[model samples]
Structures are given as C-alpha cells and as structure tokens.
Target chain A: MTGLPEPLRSRLHPLDRTLDTLETPAVLIDADVADANLVRWQQRCDRAGVANRPHIKTHRSVAWALRQLELGAEGITVQTVGEAEIMADAGISDIFLTTNVLGEAKLARLGAVASRCSLSVVADSAEIVDAAAAAARAAGATITVLVECDTGGGRCGLADPAAIAALALRIAGSEGAKFGGLMTYPGAGKRLQTEQALQAAIAACRGTGLTVPAVSSGGSPDMWKDDGLEPLTEYRAGTYIYNDRALLSRGTATLDQCAMTVLATVVSRPTAGRAIIDAGSKALTSDLLGLDGYGLVLEHPDAVIYQLNEEHGLLDVSRCSAPPSVGDRVHVLPNHTCVVTNLFDRLFIVSGGRLQGALPVEARGRSI
Target chain B: MTGLPEPLRSRLHPLDRTLDTLETPAVLIDADVADANLVRWQQRCDRAGVANRPHIKTHRSVAWALRQLELGAEGITVQTVGEAEIMADAGISDIFLTTNVLGEAKLARLGAVASRCSLSVVADSAEIVDAAAAAARAAGATITVLVECDTGGGRCGLADPAAIAALALRIAGSEGAKFGGLMTYPGAGKRLQTEQALQAAIAACRGTGLTVPAVSSGGSPDMWKDDGLEPLTEYRAGTYIYNDRALLSRGTATLDQCAMTVLATVVSRPTAGRAIIDAGSKALTSDLLGLDGYGLVLEHPDAVIYQLNEEHGLLDVSRCSAPPSVGDRVHVLPNHTCVVTNLFDRLFIVSGGRLQGALPVEARGRSI
Candidate 1:
C-alpha cells in the first residue's frame, strides 16, 4: 500500500485497497478464511448426521448468516429476541432462540418473531413456559420450547433432570407452546459431565412420556471434541466462524483460521519499550478469557498488549527485538471474537489481503 | 411494574412507562440525577475558575453535550476524529480531541474536523505533529497541537520534559499548526507526580520561549482532588456525568449520585442460590476497573454479579436474605460508566421515575 494521501491513494487503487490502507481500529473479516471455516464445520456436522445450527452471535451479520445457511447449516441459533426478529425479517425461516425470554415485553417481541418465522425458544422454568405460551397465544404464533438443562454451564438452566422433564411437560401442555427438544450450553472441558447431564435429562423426559426430538450441546472450546456419539442431534457453535486468540491458545484453530482481526495503527511511541495502539477496549473489547493481555499483535509476536484503556492499547515492547513505530499498522486477534462483534456497528470484509465492502453488524447491541 | 399483562398495563399508563416497563438490558440515564451531577460539577469548576472541558465519551450524546455547554462547559473533549466530526456536524464549535490521531487517513479526518470547529489534539511525538501539520496544510485548516506529557499516566505521552519541549517547538514551527498547550491525563492518586511533571514541562516550554496557553490535566478518579492550585488552565473530566461503581468505591460518588443504571430483568433462577440477569458483559460491559464483581445490583445489594457471559449475568445470591424470582427486574450499576455508553446505540432517558425517551448515542463507535 502506497503511503500517499488518502484520496490520491484511493484513486490510485480504485478496485480494492489493502489492509493498511483501510482506516485504523477497523475490524477485518478474511472472507476466504471465514468461508473455509464455514465449509469445514458444515462438513463435520454433515458427516455426523447431526444438524449444524450455527450461532449468529459471532458475526451478527444477516449476510454472514445467509452464507452459513448456504453452506448447509440447519438453522441459526439466536441468543435474543432482537436477533431473531432481525433474521426473521431477513427471510431466514428457521431460528432457535437460545436465551430464555421471560419478561412480557421481550416475550411479545419473540412471539412476533415466531409469527414471522419458524421460531423455537429455550426455557428452564415453568414461569418462563407460562409467559412464553401466553405471549405466543396473544400473537397467534406457535412457539417450540426447548427445555434448557444445566450441563455444567452453571449460568441459566435447571440442573435437576426431573425439573427439566417437568418443564418440557409443562411446555407441551401449554396452550401455544410445543415441546421441541433439549438444549445445553456445555461448560468447557466438561464433555463427560455434559453428556451425563444430557443423558439423564433425556431419560427423565422419556419417563414422563415426552419425546425429546433434538438434543443440542455446543461451545467453541469443545467444538472439535464432540464425537457426535453423545446424546445430541444438533450442535450450536458461534466462535468457529471466526476463531480468536483463546481458540488459538486451546489449539482448536490456527492463526490462518482466525477470520476476524482488529486493524490498528501505532499512534504513539511513548518510549523505546512502550508503544500505544489506537485500538483499545472499545474496539478490541476487554474480554481477557483467562489470558494475560487484551489481545495479541499478530505482526509483533514478542510484543505484549499489557494494558488497555477506553481508547488506548498499551504495548509492553520491552521483550521485542524490533518494536513498532507510529503510523505502522498492526492486526490484533482479540481474546473473544463474540464481544468484538458487539463492539462495532460494522466490520470491513477482506479477501486475499484485499479490502472489500463493509458489512453492518445488524444484530450488534441487540441484546434484548 | 404491575404484573398485569403488557397491553393492559401499557393502556393503563398512556404516556409514561416506568423503568419496570422498559425492556430488559436497557441503559437508563436518570435525567434529574444527571442534571444534578452536571450542576454540582459545574459549580465546583466555577469556584475553581477553570475551564471545564467535559469529555463527551461518557454520554456520547449531542443533546447532553449541548446541555453541558449550556451549563457553562468551556468545550467538549472527544477521543477520536469520528466523535469530533459528529459533534462538529451537530454545531459544537469547540472540540478537544484527547487522542493522538497519527495515520494519514485518520489525520485527514482530524483535519476535516479542524476545518469545521476549533479543534485541538494532543501529541507526544514530533512524528505526529509533522503528520498532523501536513494533513492540516493539505486540508487548508489550522489545527492546535498540545504537547502531551506523561504526568504519571503510564499509557501515553513523553516523560522527558526536554522531548516534550522539542515536540512543542516542532508544532509551533510546522505549517498550519499552532502550539496550544500542555495536556496530560494524570494518573489516579499521583497528583503530585503529575503536577511535578507538568511543572517541569511548563518550565521547559518557557525555556524554549513557548508560552503554554493551556496546561490541561484531568481524570475522573482525581476529579475532586484538584484544588486548582496546580498550574493548569483547564480540566477535562469524563465519567463524572454519571459516576459509576468505581467512583462509588473511591468515595467520590454516592448511590444517589449515580445517574446511569443498567435495567435488566432476572430471567432465570436455576438454583436456590443463583439467579441470572439478562444484562451481561454486552449491556453492562466487562470493565471491572479492579472491582470484585461485574456490577452492583441496586435492589439486591447482597447479590453479587459473579460471572458474565455475552448475554447472561450470573448472580450469587446465597448471602441475600431475599433472593430474586424469575421475571423480577433489577438495576445494575456497572463497574465503569464510559464503556456502557459505547455498548449501546441509544440510551433510555428517564426523568421523575418515568421513561422519557431514547436518546441516540451518535458517537457511540466513532473511533477511527
């Protein structure tokens, strides 16, 4: 990339600009790498005879979701009603709402989404089942309810298999709800415990005369560990589309497989041992994921991103043999890719090191 | 607030819906409390006889910025050219960009901002000054350059007074650039060191026959500690508009003074000792700021927000005598306020315990 002024340089390269020519603090999604990841994950799911329901929270782009569907994903998993609404409006017919919708205001929106598309939601309690059924009935929609099981995630789900079966029965008995299946966001490195929990929940549901059609369990850390022999019919993995530093550290993916990267410029060389990048917590996000630093500078492997402020990433380049200079552009692989998508409204798409058009993260900040 | 269904409840209150009626994972800014905070801080700055350049990073709203100016703010401090451009387009004439924009593409945008408003930027290196000066000259705009001093803020800025003085001289000698002043984001609890560094830089500038017009220093943690006795012409303070848990922990703000609160609903109660909220790192953000938990639940003070996923906030409520139930609404005072504004596209403006309207965070992700 020529270092000429922006307008002149853009005129010089009319078709596509390189990564360095793009604006700093920009999010780059290597389209080739992302497509390869999509195909690879789809092949694995296809081989296992299990449904691959890709989670849309990673990219949050309707275009990317469509691309995933084009690659043969069964249905997309949305964590919120807002995302479901967006995907449904975009003509995505099938969606699985992973998060439990309880509040009447939010459930009504979910009901509206269900009316627009084939929507299914998760519930861990009878209260949520009743509320969702009421909302669905009011909206004249049929909502499938997946009983969420606590498969060691410990966040939101019933740990007791009896409770899970009871919730499934309640949903089937409800006015506008249908008992669909079981879903569990398994904790990392707890595949055995997760399988046991799911097996117990399935058995309890069968005992209650309820047929659990689909059992879904997924997490990025355990993406490749699932042998499909577990009591699961579908898998939901979000971070596989754009693996991050955490996934790289786990050996789940390599640097070549990381689709998303934060392009930042060295704005300040404060000292010989210290350099400041324009991308900070606002751009890269403050998700450590048990890592020591916010992210890894792909160009300078020895340089450590030791600290981060709202708009400044402080790099401890003391150990680096050749530190970066001001205006030098660098790519950062964030610790968590999901939060990084939430941080930006749009991401710059790149392929073969050439800049492509920017895609808006339509589901960004759509937590509700 | 009423457990009565949504349509009935909304029809009951035709105009004003309470906080309970708002959607979960919503960011509510108490207008009254925010105005009180504005007035109180303005009064303090007024008494000190210093220019109050309130940083717009906290609210990222043009309406709030105009209100601050109406309440006698000298100017608004922006951290990026994108923010400056948004404020300048909104007719805010004076903007001080606290970040160092160095790259050609970004510097050109900063030049455009300079052409539109009274723009000033901080720089700690001659490379930045030279690049900014070239961009300014090319754009036919005059940009003010402030020599950034380390001043105990270990992130950016030069530590050596001689180097700062030399950079200031370069700014003064460069075309389309004027040496404005000395600026530093003083480290928390290092006021003396900051003052000494600033005093030395000031003296060095004087030695070089460069009379610093403005000696600006500011930080939220050190907001009240500045007695205006230190050599300074202006102070930049963000995060004071809506003091957060960090300030609350520092004894700088009380519970009644925090204007911003994340209104989330208890979605699930998987166990007797645990309840999950809809707001997580996405809505509330992951900025711990050395805090123990993600945030403080206002209603349930004993409830600890122990874990945060992208959309789930796990609360350890064993210590609480009265645990929350599903669909129960809760307000979370985040560990940091600045990052919350960046996470949302709009904020709910609440006044008199009623939801007034939603204000767009126009400069939310405007980081170049």
Candidate 2:
C-alpha cells in the first residue's frame, strides 16, 4: 500500500525541512542508516556463532522485523501474545515470546501462534507450564518453553537456578510443552561501563546448566562487548536497530549512529527563556531516564526541555547562545525509544533530506 | 463487533469472584461510575449556561466521545487534525482543534475536517491564520479561528490583546476563515490554591473589548472553583472523567472517584523492599508529576515506584505496612490520566468485579 497520503505527496514545504517539518513530536527514522545498523548487528551475531533473534519490542514495526529477517536474523522476539499475533499475521515464521505467558487468555493465544509458526516462550512457574501444555494440547500444537532465570535484572525470572530447572523439568514432562532452554535478561550487566560485569554474568549462566542446552543473554548496549559468549547459543538485541538517548548516554552509540528522533517545531515563544514546542508528553512522552532533562535537542544541544505538558514541550534556552525562534524545527532524541515508538502510528523515514516511505507502528498499542 | 476473537472466548477464565482475579498492569474502568462521572460534568455545564465541549484528548476513544454527546455535551475538543479527522469520521459533528495547526499538510487535513464538521481551531500567529485560510479555501470549507491568548500557561497564545485582535482580524478577513472569540488554557493559574487568582484571569479576558463570546476555561484541579465561570460561555474539561494521581494530590477527587486504575502483578520478588511489577514505562508510562515516583499504588499507597525499565516497574515496598508478595495484584493510579489512556488499545470496564465490556481506544495514536 502507498504509505503517503495524496495531499502529502509533494515534497514537504521547506519550513518542514528535515524530519522536523513533518510536525513537532513526530517519529523520524533515518532509513538508510537504520538499515545499516540492522545489517551490522546481524553480522556481529553471525561472527560470534550466536543466533540473531531481534526483539520487536523496540520499533514494533512488522516491516522492520521483515527487514531484520532479510538481513539474516534467525527469528524475532516479542514480549506479549498480542505482539506475537501481529507478527505472525505479517508472515514471520520463527517467533520467541521473551515474557512469561500468564492466565488462560494468553496461553490460548500462544497456542494459536504456535500452530502458525515455530513458537517458543518463557515460563517461570509450574502453573504457567501446565497452562501452556493444556492450551497447546487443546490447539493440537506443541510449544517450546524456556525457563527464565533471574540473571540480575530483578524483573521477572526464577529466583534460583534450582527453581529454573524445576520449571524446565515441568515443561519437559508436560503433555504438549517442550523444554527449550534458559533465558536471562541481565539488564544491569548490559549497561555496565566496563565488560567485566557482563563476563561475570556469562560465567554465572554457564555454571547453572540444569540440563538446559541453549542459554540466552542479550541487550543492545553490550552488543559489541560480547565476551564469554561461547556458552550461549542465541543473543536477542532490540535497541541495536535504533540507538536512543539512554543507550547513547551509556556510550553505546554516537549521536550520528542514533537512527530515530522526534522532529518537532517551536510553536509558541511565550517567554525569553522558555519556548513551547508542538510535541508535548503525548508526542515525546515523559520517560526521563536519570537524564538531565526530557530529551536531547539535535540542533540546540544546549537547550533543555525543562518541562513537558500533554501537548506542549517547554524548551529552556537560558543557557543557549541564541534562542530558537518560532517555526524553527528541532529534532529531539527521546530518553526511552521503545515507549516513544509506541506513541506514534507511523514513522517517516528520511535520508539526506529526502523523504523515504513511511512505516506503520503495527504493534503500537499491543499492551495486553 | 465483538472485540475479542471467537477462539479466545473459551479461554477467558471468569474471575472467581466479581473483580477478584484481575492481573496487575491491566487497565480497569468502572462502567457505571464512569457513566455517572460523564453525566455529572454535563450537568455542571447545563446549569451554568455554557456550552459543554468535552475534550476527547483525555480518552481518545470514539465510543467514549459518543457517550459524552449522549450525556449532553455540545461538541468535543481535540488537540490535532488527525484526532479531529478520526472523531469526524466517527460521526462527531462538532470539533475544536485545541492546539496551533501549523504546516500545509496539517492545515490541509484541518481544512478537510472543517468541511465535514462544525470545526474550529486556535491560532497564535497571523501566518498560521493565513495557512488555515488557504487550506480551507482549497478544500471548499470554512473554519472558525480562535485567537489563543496566553493567560498564565505560557504554552500557546498571545499575551497582548492587541496582537490577539490583529490575528482575529486576519482570520475574519480571510477567504475561508472566520474570527471566533479568544481561548486560554489557564494551566499555570489553576494551581493558585485560591479562587481569587482564577477570577483575576477571567477579569483580564473581559477587560479586552473583543466581546468575549466563548470564554473557555478548564483544569480539573480548579473545576470545582468555578467562581471565574461568570464570563465563560463554554468550558473544556477532560480529566474530570477519570481522576488521576495528580488530581488526587491537588484534592480535586477522592480515590473512589478515580474511575481508571492500572491493574499490575508483582512479577518478581528480587529483594525484600524491591518487587518488580509487569507494568513498566510501556504499561504505566513514565510521567512523574513532581512526585516521588511514577504512580500511586491504590491498594498500598505507601509502596513507591522508584524505578521503571521498558517492561518492568520497580516498587519500593520498604515503607509499606505490608509488602506485596510475588504474584499479588495491585492497582496503580498513573500520575497523568490522559497518557495512561493512550497506552492501551482496549479498556476493561468493570463494576463490583464483573466484566462489563471492552472499549477500544479508537483514537489512541491519533497524533498528527
């Protein structure tokens, strides 16, 4: 389908130059560079002898996931049954749900997805395994279940290795559930300033075999710092495709390497130090990740978005050498990329001031 | 049409008791109570001799907008042309674009919407007025333009009455644009902690000889202190339907009056004081409104959400009288109500624990 509406077919007005002209608080992706980022990550995983299972939670675009597969990714990882359903409908064959499947509603959906694709999911409890087994049996399909272990993210996982093994054993013995392996996020280990912590996490995962064949440890920040990965068979990284402000702050990628940004315009200059942009919390979102302000201004890095209302972003320009006038377009790198991507229905792809095709955020509201 | 698929219906395990089995990180709305809240707001405007133009930006749902009209709302207020188009397509005849419509693409969309609906939009500049006029003429439509005056919000609007008059004149003389009266947000003035300050803003607007036909003023925190409504011919309030943590902090609504809450589950018990919930930046959002954390635990107000990752919310339960154990379900009132509504595709309507129906967030990502 043609992405651009007929009215927006002509080259956008010069006032809307760059991605900024598209409107304030609209998602902009540098298509040429984002594609390059995807290819680079796939190559890195291929060289490391690890399966490149790209996570779809970052961009939530079926088009992007297909591109990842075309660039040589083994499969795609989704966090929810709703997301997996979207990807499955888009013709993705191999899918991995990295989140725990709870309740009967989700398990039935999971079983349906398993029938359509090479499906695998993580489970932390025996009850969840039993539910998955019953749903898979009812659907006449078998699903691969991985035991999720707490590798220090402190989020969702089995607290101890014995608990993880017990869950894996339950899945193996279940009627329609097959034990795949173990999955660990190691979220804190990924964002470490040095590689020593990540190495330690790999060692810990290696020590806890419990008859598990494949060990999954993944995050984008340490994508390049892959040490002690000989014990792991697969790596899942989402943000490597579109490095954001938070990842950039951790020294993962440079500003130019960051592919996604919110293009916004100065709509109101109400005060000398303060100017309101068209994009507010609804557009840019309010995900402040221990950063100084809301986001980083691409044009005026010195300008700080001190506050954000529902439909207005307040840019503090007191420290700037020259204030941005009204109608000026500015690119803001959001603190958290995933949440911001979910806020927009489509993303405009641009390269060297040329507007590429638009891609829909297909899984934009798959919260369930 | 039924929102859920037929195959998924049998898997739905009805709550053991009414409202007892809801998992955390889920959105719950009391259908009967929410309907009452809508009726109450409509009644307030009916008695005050003002047009009740409810803002749909809060819920972003066509079903909810229709319900508001059924409850006697004259029209609806939207923040973007994209939203206006969605509402117009959904059979909402009247709409007010509450934000500045800039650029040719947005102005063109606005013009198209104006042709189909009783559409009006706010502008802070003569340039924007001309753009709107050009687009409206091309689309063979006429639009009423309101001069957005900066009261104390410092977001969008002209501070000077003369400048406002000039912009109004520009719209009045334009080919397809007509001058409507003035509009102001009164955002900063809402938290004045006294009724006298809010009255001062109304007096300032009346001081101008612009006739002041439609003096629209609203903010849920000061909705009850409507002493300033003597001059307001219309009111645009959004949050009175679903009170949030911010409104509760300002003493606008009690916990029971809060019709919306996020049901979340404790996914991980990493430590004693720290428990991770399935809801994170993706589910609850990261809107910390000058509070200690992102949201308030409805069941355990003392349990503070200290940190949030993409798919994990960290709860600091050290101060709680009784800490939430793993697998416990909790309800969280988000800091901002509008944002939470935008995050979900469907809202579960519940009353005394029985599942009423699922309402789709039809206009969830309608940000142009």
What DockQ does each candidate score versus the true complex, computed on alpha carbons? 0.73, 0.42
Alpha-carbon deviation at A146 in model 1, angstroms: 1.0
Once model 1 is optimally superposed onto the true structure by TM-score, how far is the C-alpha of residue B172 displaced, in angstroms?
1.3
- lDDT of each model, Cα atoms only? 0.86, 0.76
Worst 10 residues of 2 chain A by lDDT: A5-14
Model 2: per-residue Cα lDDT over B1-368, one tens digit each: 13322222322334432355444457887755666677788888898888888888888877778878877888999988778988898888989888877775677778789889898888888767877888889899998888787767666777765566667667778999877777777763443422343344345444553344566666677776756676567888898788788888888788778888888777556567787777888887888787778898878889889888766788888898889875677888888889988888777777555675566777887777
lDDT of 1 by residue, B1-368 (tens): 24322221232223344566678888888877988898889998899888899999998888788888988999999998888998998899999998888766777788888888898988888888888888789889999999999987798898898998999999999999999999999888888888889899999999999989999988888788855348888889888999999999998899999999998889898898999999988888788889999999999999999889999999999999999999888899999999999998888877667776677788998877
In model 1 chain A, which range of ten residues has the least summed lDDT? A4-13
lDDT of 1 by residue, A101-155 (tens): 8766777788888888888989998888898899899999999999999988887
For candidate 2, write residues A26-99 as lDDT tens digits: 78887667877887888888888899999999989887888889788889999878889999998999999887
Model 1 docking grade = medium
